[model samples]
Target: MSEERETPERRRERLRQEELKRNPAGSIHGGGLPDLVGGMGWKFTGILILLLIVGFLIYSLFFR
Candidate 1:
């Protein structure tokens, strides 16, 4: 029986997979904040910003 040889691209991909398995957070940044914002759809983001602006206006009118 002949052993299968891995191609260069396959070898590179395999090494990357092994590295990821060893260090799952090898490419993480900002500790999940980016993930949270990315998962929020544009519609939700728009509504959230609108609500914040309205709340700030109300607070300024009453407290300032």
Candidate 2:
């Protein structure tokens, strides 16, 4: 039917609109910083922090 046919761009826009309706905050603001932090979980975040600390210690000992 005519209603079922959509150009690819129009279909993508339609899907984007539906996503906005479902997650207005994320759709509008690119999910924000909290979304990124929450998605990483405490374990991964801790590991990242540990690696940064180790890297900083190595840099200070060797380069400075």
Top candidate, metric lDDT: 2
Kindly report which residue stretches of model 1 are placed more than 4 angstroms away from their true locations once superposed. 1-33
lDDT of 2 by residue, 1-64 (tens): 2447886545655676788799787656485654555557679888988998999999999997
On TM-score, the leading prediction is 1
Counting clashing residue pairs in each candidate, in order, gives 0, 0
Off by over 4 Å in 2: 1-33
The true-structure Cα RMSD of candidate 2 reads 10.3
Q: What local lDDT score does residue 57 receive in model 2, on the 0 to 100 scale?
A: 98
- What is the lDDT, from 0 to 100, of the residue 29 in candidate 2? 48
Worst 10 residues of 2 by lDDT: 29-38
Q: All candidates' TM-scores? A: 0.48, 0.46
| Cα lDDT tens digits for candidate 1, 1-64 | 1226875545655666688689988756542544455556669878988998999999999997
What lDDT score belongs to each candidate, Candidate 1 first?
A: 0.68, 0.72
